[model samples]
Target chain A: MDYLEKEILVLGCGNILFGDDGFGSEVIQYLQKNYNVPSNVYVDDAGLSVRTILFNIVLSEKKPRKIIIVDAVDLGKPAGSTFHLDVDEMPEIKCDDFSMHQVPTSNLLKELKNFCKVDVKIIASQVQYIPEEVSLGLSNVMRDSIPSACEMILKEMSPL
Target chain B: MGKRIIIQPVSRIEGHAKVTIQLDDLGNVADTRVNVVELRGFEKFCIGRPVEELPRIVTSICGVCPWSHHLASAKANDAVFGVTIPPAGKKLRDLCNSIAYTEEHILHFFFLSGPDFVMGPDADYSVRNVIGIAQANPEIGKKVVRNRHLGTQMLDIISGKSIHPVTAVPGGFSKPLTQKERDKVLPMAEEVLEFAKFSIAFAKENIFPKYLDTVKVLGVFNSGFMGTVSEDGALNVYDGKLRLMKPDGSFTDFAYDSYTDFIAERVEEWSYLKFPYAKSWGEGFSMDVDNPKGIYRTNSLARINVADKMATPLAQKEFEEFRAKFGRPAQLTLLYHWARLIELLYNAEHAVELLNDPEITSRETRVPVTPRAARGVGCVEAPRGTLIHDYETDDKGLITNLNLIVGTTHNNAPINMSVNQAAKLLIKDGKYDQGILNRVEMAIRAYDPCLSCATHNLDGRLPVRIDIVDSEGILINTIQN
Candidate 1:
């Protein structure tokens, strides 16, 4: 894999301040610490307002060939499994359950897709304890899957 | 030449809404309407869900005030569960509520609503938003952003996220606070406390004076006050009885959980919004001050009035002065913004105190309990007003039914009233100017209604259709009046 072709943008969306739903952010934090990727690869906290991040994508003039969003998707899956999905095919993400400050990155992706030609993907970890009384940390299963999920994402950005 | 207009989908405020204004016979605003449109089916959808799911389910009602919904839902769940949460749970919930208020008010004032006031009312539509705010006063703008960041940061440290918080549970919190997290949260809260203080002082000194004449001359000031009063007569947010005070100083109180007994909702033909009135008081007159019967308002100012006095010294002092100056708890709707800032101070201060408390960090974030067939009512002070969640559940902890009497629902009538008043006030003397009508729109935006959450349906665009009408209610030359 050529270094120049290894361009990857790993963006973690959603507010980490809100309990188990912050799994994506927690995963991003882990990836930031452990992942060894080419210089073209970049990671962003993105936070809860994923919509705001879209502007950077469209207006960057130098558009990236691909974008990956890491978030806690409520797929009713077991706590730890990783689901890689094409942004357009994922279930209609419900932005209501979270905070008002947030517009779903998926929604933002849909909006951006209209104006640009970026290959957008979502890497969502399932959340079982959202809306329940819980801490901000991911569940045990979600936490355990971080390294492997990060590795898979790195692999997807392969052929550099 | 035809005038240009742009209606941004899902107007960037609370809940969901869209704006539409018509051009005059001479390319000016002949009429304007800010549509409070969102068809949320929370009440209908909530029907038949297990009562225990009320807290979690209703928390999705609005991203802005999930904490309020969570509390109201939890309290309703508790009522249905036929068990009262312990004192610590109640206080912790109140603390969470306060944090929610602090975060929301700051978002509304500084980020959402503040832009118009800060960057001239007629600033370019695109730039008059957050980006515009960033360009105009970078220092204050950065401070506003940082203040919100600090508040959300603390919320994340405590509950998980500032929005869609996860700290709340049906029985209680999922986990208790650790000293380290509490310690981390405190200093950040202190910064927010400082910012909140600075905001109050800034309001008193800078912002308040600028809007003083505007408040006195232009804003809606005659609505009655409503809020939750503690058993001991305090401005209790988490667990308390509901109260609706009349403009003439009369009041009614019901068990917080028994919302159905005291309040009845009347839906208007023109709007999907429901206007709640005190069932005891009977119906409301159409914007008539003489026989004001509807449950008028909730949240910051009303909460200040319902409680004996504010717990914090600054808030108490401000509350006293506000009441003294306006006479009987400033009924003016615009003052809610100021009152919200004042409460932000109180909320931040309260959060600081909670964070500093050594016991807050204790590892008992949960209260073990089992669900039973019962009804519960949880009420909390959302940034807009008092939000009540009533739920009935089965023994298995599934929600059987749910009802969210949101703060915006109560203020629905007053919102239309204010809009009508502003339209009339601005359109007087045959003025069809866009700037004049924008002032009227700004007045309505000040309330920050969360109608989308009230209805349970989250999608709708408010295509504002403002038409000029004659004195006899006939359609006069229709324009964006």
Candidate 2:
């Protein structure tokens, strides 16, 4: 419930079991450990349960002014490359195709923006290697990108 | 002259899977197969790790059913350490399981598979989704969303986090329920119970009647069933003896550790996942739709079928009514939804019953534990089906071996059989469209099989691509939706 009281909310979404997919969660860790976050801001490692958390936020009485999501995606770009996308810029996903566990984080972000009137932004890094096996820890390229992703998230929070 | 039709990444279910239907030269359905990507190296990942860390580590297995894994692992840890959890600890774990079941059943019935029944299965794909359901029936949609949110809120209040719980430990729960916490949760439990009542009544009155015929015949097959039951032969999800029921409604019960004596897993060359049948039944495995040899099912319908009665009163009544209509061991695949709702009622009522128990708030939540070398098996009725965790540890308290048979894996063979039967019935003379293909997928969805959990994918993307090929394995067409 305290999460709803924040002016800004940052969600790090991905599975830590996969190599590069843990980037978003790692960014959240880096931010919390190294930065001086404002009291009005709340950072969460949403993990694979992003939809559940987002649903709770949507139904909450109090809503954050702005929500930022950090994720690792397959954007067909060079490994470790990062980009920012507004809610509208996300790809169109079929409504019926949505899943609570496997849904693209952007779809929920868009829904919150249109339905709840909240400003939404996504910070994404192109994944380098997602292992087929049960592997932990990120690839070196993704590991190197974590600091920049953390700085970018901090800069986004600065204006707020 | 023959043709093959594939439906990849069947939508509206957990994880990813593909369905392939092969046709003969005359264009009649010849054979069918359901393929899944199984996650490898998982058990290997547990090797050399401290056994106590399993309850925490296993939560990462599946995002959807973390509580089930959390508690099952905790119970396994208790067994391994040869410690009995205190009464408060056991009640707390059961309480969390009941609440988790309510949330999962509601989500699956209303959002995941609700579209097929609510909007009509033949409805356009665009309008047959959660959003479409909201637009079509705003009143019901509002209630569903609010009630589901309440379920999540209840979990958050009790377990600290709804997705990946940390309270369950080797001997007991890490946290106890204070009087104030129980007081806050009591009203929420009551609200969820009322919603559970409304859900079944609403579905019975509005949904099931229209699909009665389909309910009886769609994906119908004969198979044995499995579930957990109390000593008095009543349904118990968290703790009980395993009941393996024959297709004729007769059953035999066994202790959790004695599972190997009754059950065995068979692996097929075509699929990475294993097929688990009743080995004690003394029949070799076969998915032949006409006469399946050793096929059996687990999940809501199976649980309802295998149990003598429900422990909770409301669910017991519903079980009687369900049996009156479908007979014992209901073969109707679509009835899983109905059975799921009934279990929801049971879980909600069970939660309230636990919350009202005096020992639920007792201060002694955990018992001290000393670890030694031991092998233990923990079993629970996951929302999808029966989940079992088998673990072995060295004297140093480090895991030596681990094996997990998730709820969905138990239904792997049956899912393939159901899809095959449905496809053979629906697609005639190679004539089928999107709706027909979806009907085929409906057969699989009835199982609510969580291939993601079965496969253990960290990145939850199961891209489904349906490829149509000719008799000679030549590419003919491709379908992606």
Candidate 3:
């Protein structure tokens, strides 16, 4: 489907090459392997390309109605805790980020939510241990949380 | 008292760009350092993995330029496995590189560095961005987005996936382009070529003229240039001999295998990034703009400056005009934008040219390969700069050592030099405004350095928060724009 045709996007946003940092995509993998998400809800592992995908949506003339982000986060909760976080609650991690595209700032998600009028939401799990280097796969704690995260994501998109 | 000022933008993803600028007692710029994250850990991570798997795994390091990594890794693997890919295989790789460059150069020009040139550098932060560009130039914005999407769509059709591509394997491209796929992609390449023409024309007429004054001064510095070029000195990003052009327009061409003899890294305090200088120049290292010793740049501006000519006609014409105007080895950093547009046109033309070749659709893309203990060095001109992936393997084909001198790493010192030059020129007597700071940001933006490629954070955009402090580190002024 064309990107605009999708009403909701469930984007798994993290690199799986890094240990527990792959939580978001791990959930997406679990969903792809296990669940049957409807066509209206587009799901994929965004990985490190999250910013570019989000930037495209913001620049796009027609945006999806909602963007659901699934990623690993450090909320200081239990290692495997999964929860829904509001965009406003996201730390000022937002900045004038510069990659090749040098996509501009506030936070991109916040921009989608506030400026673009898209319902942007996040489903995140506290990482057990994100390796300082490249160590593939999720730790048992983070790996164990994937099914619940997938379930939570499906439940959130239940209206769809 | 001298002051240490830190310009940091917080990002949880990959620790983003952290630039530290030191000020003398008079509040004049003393020094600047573009602090990027380390890649050594990731290098070590590749050690135990199978040599063949590296081409797939390395793409995970940077989302922004995965294709560049994928190709470089594949090339390195080919060198290790001692196999020369079939003609169709080489064409496929070249075609993909050109297409990816088309996508990258367009996005960097229209989205990343667009606003500063289009809206004027001093415009307010809110309206001086991508959304603002869309609002102001709706038609142009649409074209930019559409052309970029077309590039992605083409990559998707060529390779099964655009992001984290594994199509580029050790011996050759894993997949070949079918005639039907080539036919489908041809029109898109032609369309992007048209856009590339419009983009450069638009910039020359509207965007560049307004910023010419700023271009002359901001980030202005003299340094050597580095890039890849074909045998006859034509600009070739996919495969070529490495050229290191000195500040005086003189250059030395060398093979990638002997890159270590020409370039060496100065490990200053073992920071997140390594400072590589021209060892062959034998000037040690320095970022002093007035008398930079061994500093050299690698990116669009550098590529254009070093190359004798562009491979394609339209780009060659644009390149001639650029060289005629700026002279060879342009010192003005802002001209990177100008040089970038020229490359954009080159890639666009190159893509169309590649698509026209019959071999691009050939099925004999891959060749047989046998694993053996070997060391290989592969280099490509990534959109940002020269990307060198050096690797070694055991007899069993397991990786023993690997070092990736990514595009951004080559520009590490020059970025600092540009920011320092910008800071020195703009900030005076400890007084500065958001406009001044944005200009400072603009200098760094001109190179269009991929911070994600630098530090592995896809969203590693630099939201510069400059803090001015005294020698004792007492914060006096903070500018967060």
Candidate of highest lDDT: 2
lDDT of 2 at B197: 99
Model 2 segments more than 4 A misplaced: A2-7, A33-42, A55-65, A76-81, A86-118, A158-160, B456-466, B479-481
lDDT of 1 by residue, A70-147 (tens): 887766787777888666555544443222322212234654455567777778777656532222356677788788
DockQ of each: 0.08, 0.34, 0.43
Q: Write the per-residue lDDT of candidate 2 for residues B87-168, one digit (tens) a residue.
A: 9999999999999998889888987888888988888766777667777877776677667777777777877877768999
lDDT of 2 at B316: 92
Candidate 1 shows a clash count of 50
The CAPRI-style docking tier of model 3 reads acceptable
Q: In model 1 chain B, which range of ten residues has the least summed lDDT?
A: B456-465
Q: What is the descending TM-score order? A: 3, 2, 1
Clashes of each: 50, 0, 6
Per-residue CA lDDT of candidate 2, range A1-160, in tens? 3566788999887778767877888899888898898888888877766766675565455678889889887767899988897666543322212244222232456667887898887898888888888889988888888888888888888764
Candidates arranged by DockQ, highest first:
3, 2, 1
Model 3, B1-481: lDDT tens digits are 8877776752222236776778787877877777777643787778878899988888888888899999999999999898888989989888889999988888888777787777777787777777778899989888877888888889989998887788998889889999999999999999999999998999899888887888888899888999999999999999989999999989999999899999998777736788899999998898778999999999999999889998999999999999999998888998988999999999999999999998888889999888789998878889989999999998888889988898888887888888888989987876667777677778887877776765644243346567877878789877665
Query: What value does the lDDT take at residue B140 in candidate 1?
Result: 67
CA lDDT of each prediction against the hidden true structure: 0.62, 0.83, 0.82
